[model samples]
Target: MTANRVLYLLGSAAPPVLNIAGVIERAQAADWDVCLGLTPTAARWLDDELPALEELTGHPVRSQYKLPREPDVWPPADVAVVAPATFNTINQWALGITDKFVVGFVAEAIGKGIPIVTMPCVNAAYVRHTQFDASIATLRVMGVHVLYGDGGFVPNEPGQGRPNGYPWHLALDAATSALTRRDAGRE
Candidate 1:
């Protein structure tokens, strides 16, 4: 199969945000042309590394919506992974809320039949929110591969996330598997 264009959608959770370089390296090694879209707060968190990340991906890291007449700079995504998907982002995305650029792209990707794999990086405390479980269920019903709980992203205790334990590879693996499944169906 040809190399897939992967969009790495990042939210404002600390673990994956801090270790984004590993995510990029693994994706590139897997023959993916990766681009990044950061939620606004995530952009702020990774401000200093933005230039390096852009250089690594060879595409601008988008954090805001482009103007109506402006052409999109990044390649059209064949698959997307929303790693470090926060509680807020998950809920907003499921609800079709497009207040942020990342959420807007994800919502549109759903309609366009683009395969999306998401690994939520929320704490146990936040995971207990009533809307959180419902939102995840809704996204799953929409055909999104949500990596949470067993065999996926287990919820970390409040303030207990270890950067080393964040499952960036799992998200990438899921994205590749989803793409493979999608292509097989076509054949």
Candidate 2:
């Protein structure tokens, strides 16, 4: 991977979003030019850090749709990683509900054939809801690399969530692998 590779690291309002700065640094170290996008709530959560985050990525951290007249803000994404995807975000994405900027971009990325990797941060109780599993299945059917179950996110109990333990690496690895496979296909 070269520094020219652009990574769209889209985040939802999960506890792990707090660790985004560190994750961005890791991605940069791995040779990706990262662009950060956040859900509205996640943006608020990191409001105090937005300027620093933009300075770090060298791109604006966007949380809403740009005006139609506005030029594109960042380079095109070679891959996208949706980490700490929350229960609401997952369902909305699977159902084609593009109300939020993060979900909208990812949902469209599917049709654009942009490789996507996502790791849910929901709890065991939330997974028990019928819609949760169904949504995950739907995303997989639509070509999103959902990092759940055995090798990926295993839901913890609701009140007992571990923010620091979220596997950021899994989503990052999957994203880079997608880019690798894509590059291979070009040969």
Candidate 3:
């Protein structure tokens, strides 16, 4: 199977709220299979873009999981991205709680050695919390790439792209560069 399949786990963080498009665009350029894994909270913000994304990627966008109908038709993702990850989700996943399908999928991915990337978009208050720090440390130890969100640096104002601040495209570029390097060594 091609290793392009990606499970994008969404969170309620604001910056990731804006960076999802850039991430998806980058993933597509890298020939990745992008799947939208929305948390219950994320569903609220997905607004009208979810269906279009499903159509564009040609993969089912899922926030929940059912029994694998055919062993291959389920929530199996090669790479998983939890962007704008909330501390709640982080804590739950670290502790092995899968109440939400998104959390469940992440839990399973970690157990199976799937590469999972997490971009946390939280205020300074939550970011500095001790429990949040502990969760981040645990996730890193478990091989999850934790991407810190834009704090004071708002890429874009409300309802706009990061006009003047640090563009999220930079992150996408780095991710692609890393992939290119990995592929180069293989060749």
Locate the minimum summed-lDDT window of 10 residues in model 1: 1-10
lDDT of 3 by residue, 81-168 (tens): 6665666888888788888988887788777866666655555566566888788789888877666543222222335523224334
Name the best candidate (by TM-score): 2
TM-score of each candidate structure, all chains considered together: 0.95, 0.98, 0.72
TM-score of 1: 0.95
Clashes by residue pair, model 3? 4-33, 155-162, 156-161, 156-162
Better structure of 2 and 3 per TM-score? 2
Candidates ranked by lDDT: 2, 1, 3
Writing each residue's lDDT as its tens digit, candidate 2 over 1-187 gives: 4589999999999999999999999999999999999999999999999999999999999999999999999999999999889999999999999988999999999999899999999999999999999999999999999999999999999799899999998888998899999899989
lDDT of 3: 0.62
* Residue 40 local lDDT, model 3: 67
**Model 1 residue 112 distance off true place after TM-score fit, in angstroms:** 0.4
Q: Mind giving the per-residue lDDT tens digits that candidate 1 earns over 67-112? A: 9999989888888888889899999999999999989888999999
